[model samples]
Target chain A: MKIFNYFGNYFSNRETFQEIIVIPVFATLLAIFLGLLLLIVSGSSNEIALKALIALFYGSFGSISSISETLTAATPLIFAALGIAVGFKAGLFNIGAEGQIILGGMAAVIIGFSFQLPFFIHLILILLVGALFGALYAFISGWLKATTGAHEVITTIMLNLIAYRLLDFFLRIPSIQKEGRNDPISKSILDTAELPRILYFLDPNLRVHMGFLIAIFAVLIVYWLIFYTTIGYEFRAVGKNLEASRYSGISPSMTIILAMSIAGLLAGLAGASQIAGVLGRATPGFSAGIGFDAIAVALLGRAHPIGVLFAGILFGALIAGGRQMQVSADVSLDLITVIQALIIIFIAAPVLIRKLFPWIFR
Target chain B: MYFKKFLKISSGAFAGVLLMTINSANAFTACQVTDVGGVDDKSFNQTAWKGVQDAVAKHGIDSKLLESKSETDYEPHLNSMVNAGCDVIIAVGFLMGEATKNAAEANKDSKFTIIDFAYDPTVPNILGQVFATDQAAFLAGYVSAGVSKTGIVGTFGGINIPPVTGFMDGFAWGVKHYNKVKGKNVQVLGWDPDAKEGLFTNNFDSTDDGKAFAQNLYDEGADIVMPVAGPVGLGSASLADELGSDKLKIIGVDGDWTQTDPARKSVYLTSVLKKMDVTVLSVIESVKSGSYSGGVTVGTLENGGVGIAPYHDLSSEVSSELASEVEALRKGIISGSIVMNK
Candidate 1:
């Protein structure tokens, strides 16, 4: 009681705290409560359901290895969600992040396995190429939206389907496919192009890599670009009211195109990070629906870079803990997905959350 | 605030629940990690898990499985199984080869049996289960050749991979063998062993593609069609049902689809069996008996690991003479008197 009051008093000092902080916090709690109820109603004993909940939390942040797992899982999410946030701030719904990611990953893997350049130079080149590829892919959608008034949602969805086939076509090429394997697996990237694990000194098992730091760097850059820069100011202005911003001497088309391109660049880095850091090679569907999940992350974060960072970690925790829950508690992994969907639903309707917990508003 | 009061009460309740002990571990736990097709894909994953269930019912060995939703889940799921201290972890499908190999090396104490893959050097702690599905598929081809009213049988694959092709190759060769034996000019469609080119849907999940391919083969005068695609073959089976067994008969694959998809049993001439469940159960039982060792186990007709299923509802349609000849061919191949392919 005292702890809640103390935190409430501390948070109530800021006007934006209710919408940004309290609402999300309450939404998460409400979702978890409902998830537990779901488990119990679905025929799990009370003890088993409680055990599953504890396993979920413990698997997320219980120890150093668990923390590393959470961070490792969070890396790509943070990168992609930050990109989605940038697009949202410009009033464009860029659903093409998945295609952008696929292109970026494909580009990175080609560069990763093909050349033998110096370590840092090779990695930087691969990342830049990946970012460039993603930016180019997204630029098409932005350009279409700016010039022809085609809906980004439709264009991006179609592009995603094309990207999957494109990956398949590329992977089938004799030069790109792994030697002696007829399967759709690509050649493994060179060691020099690999993203070295950051916690190798602490424990070789800890999979948290340099990508975590880069994701944080991306967060800082996106934060500054969103909150401090003039381009960002224009982006928010266009997002707030596009017709009014155009009348006020801002170029709506330019802002929309630039915002989407930036978004794509960040997402491309995510694909690059996964290839270089975690997977080491591109397989068909290797983006693993991270781009789709990032939409939820961005929405949950209210399309703020800082909020996306935390939301990414929270989602990462859910994934890592979901595995643990499955292993220890013998619960189906689908339960975690249900919980994630519940969280997204609650966050999407913050009014419902605020109404449910009206005393938090007071 | 009421919110704070609720939080306090919940926290207190959670603290109390956290102290409760988890259930004790079971003895001789065998676990499986499924491929992206999942455990219930009516394919290898499902067949492999069936072996574990059979072992549980027979030997009382506890069974568990973690389904891989994507490729990324492979390594993590393997690691989770290792962490859970599973005695034998069965990795289903060839896609899990690298992850299984890495995990086998990392955890030498844990025994692993991977379906559809074998290590080149033979890892000490892993038993690779590779089926001579071609052997069973050869018999299926003979049956198809025998049963086809049009003197032409067709076979196709999901992809140009060896697992799929092995079945197609054997089927084609069996038709050729049947041609030589009966002095009949029975033609094989959709596959040529010499050139190694054939019809492929390039997908294992799309029933639409399956239906189209079957229709094309049937239109080409192939009365019996063998589809080596996993769930995609169900589309052909449904088409066969609509067309009637007299007009179009289907050959099933992986498990005996007559049993797996019993609702459509009447349309099957005979299924090419891979026997993943039989092999998986034997591996688990060997582990239980302390006789488990790491090596590639090739499932062939001689070992009863792979064979053709009984001609269930269509038994009356197949002549006893044809059935006797198939038995002879199976023996002749096992005895090295008959060659399946060039």
Candidate 2:
């Protein structure tokens, strides 16, 4: 009974409850409706489209293995999205997450292969080094923003380009590359450095690891830092209004630098998790586009830590299920991107949803 | 009004779900997972998919395709096919080499074939399909040199990878062979066969970069340019068309440009063909007939795996004497009289 009351109070006290829950749900439904409409317009039978949708659902959450795959897919997104959410809270648009992710993964893989230490210590040290590298990569943009008023958007994009070339250059070096192979592939991390599979008992093929748990913990830490701590207050204050924050004895530059550093740290953890947990080795474009997708995840989550967690899982499910949909229903996987775009469009413009369902708002 | 719309959508979705639940039983299921370029890339992936489609049409085999949006999708896509109970899985592109190797090792019972890349320490269930495309590209190089009025032909790649550089290396050698035979000092631009350095866009998708590379080669006084970059090569064709065929001609790669890019057919001198479809069909056939074995399958000019496409629009441009000369060179390369250094 006390737990119920605590939950009720938690819900009632937050004015953002509707923004965090109601709006996103409504937008998702509307976007799905529009996606079905598109399927029909594209000449797919109603039965075929729905089968594809069901296949997507089953593929994502159908069984233990499927759920494991979903979590595996979501792990990196959770870290990167939370990082983006934290940056958003501080009114900083850190578009350098992709670059940070690459550098972080590279750092982790370099340390992972170089060391021969005990399991937990090795993992912790590699993750920390990876995060530091990511933080330092983003610090360039943060420092530039603080010192020269350079927009992070531009700097981060340029940094992303540089990071790509730098990775290619690093992979070409003889020592870093795989033995007897000229391709841009790095050596596989030692088995001891790998993040042990969480479900090896169930089925050895399951790829989910401890990264998901770490991501959840990061979410809690980010939530506490954003809403409960003094630094959190400063971040939110600066985000709400830079001039007012400066006048209230908050150093805007310091806040900007701190937010970016923390954001980079989270994004870096994402890279480290992928290397130490999922891939177990480094390859060119290993980050894929997860860092970029994190922007959408952050926006859809309304830039809240808890929101980002669920949002990451949702995206992960969509990705995992999209493969299943392709396999079972014979639908093109590109449909997933279309659905994602539609959801973002509806979320970005809430007026349309409110206009269509005014009674729901009331 | 919203409630009515919701009812319509729900009913449609319900009907769709019912239709999807119906399963079809088949004797064999063949699946393909394409690289990041997807199945409709109009290059390697597309051609490989055609082979899968051919198996479905001819052999009554169930077929499915999954496109990888990025590098991360490779493992999952392969795993999904394995989970779906596919009898044979085909992975296209050199980028999928590692994932295919890992998948083949993990699932020993499932038969796998990889295109454009060979695995080291071969696995029992996996067949690596590789093409000696340098042979065909050599033909393209010779043809381009013979057709060049300015005594200059150029070639560039998407990256400095072996598959890409194989085309450029052969093209450069063809030009070198042309100079040795004719005693004419025809210069090849963008690549130095001896130094192994040349121009590359470092990507396979950007048309603008392809156009810039082609333009750069042309600016250096080359009338013929061959771009080994995938979609990037289209930019070169487009630039060739824009500059007028009188000033420039393009040598296409992979599939024949006359068929792949009909709009720019006029600029295509001929294409260096890599018969991915033929190799893929053969692999599927082997799996279907219970004759599949794990080993390397090399596609060379001798086996019709790699060859030069016909000079379609440019057919009139090649004299009978020159056509016979190119054919003789092809025969020489196959018969061991002529050796390609690269």
> Could you tell me which residue pairs clash in candidate 2?
A47-B16
TM-score of each: 0.92, 0.94
Give RMSD (Å) of candidate 1 vs. truth. 4.8
lDDT of 2 at B264: 86
Tens digits of lDDT, candidate 1, A180-204: 8766789999999999999999867
Write model 1 residue lDDT over B161-274, tens digit each, in one string. 788888999999999888888899889899887777888876667788888899999999999999988878889988899999899999988888888888999998888888
lDDT of 2 by residue, A214-311 (tens): 99999999999988999998888887788998998999999889999899999999999999998888877799888998998997888888989998
Candidate 2 regions exceeding 4 Å error are A1-13, B1-27
* CAPRI classification of candidate 2: medium
The DockQ figures for the candidates are 0.43, 0.51
Each model's iRMS: 3.9, 3.3
Put down candidate 2 lDDT per residue, B102-207, tens digits, no spaces: 8888899999999877777787898999989989888888888888999998988876677888899899898888888888888999988777778877666778
lDDT of 1 at B294: 99
Candidate 2 chain A — worst ten consecutive residues by lDDT sum? A6-15
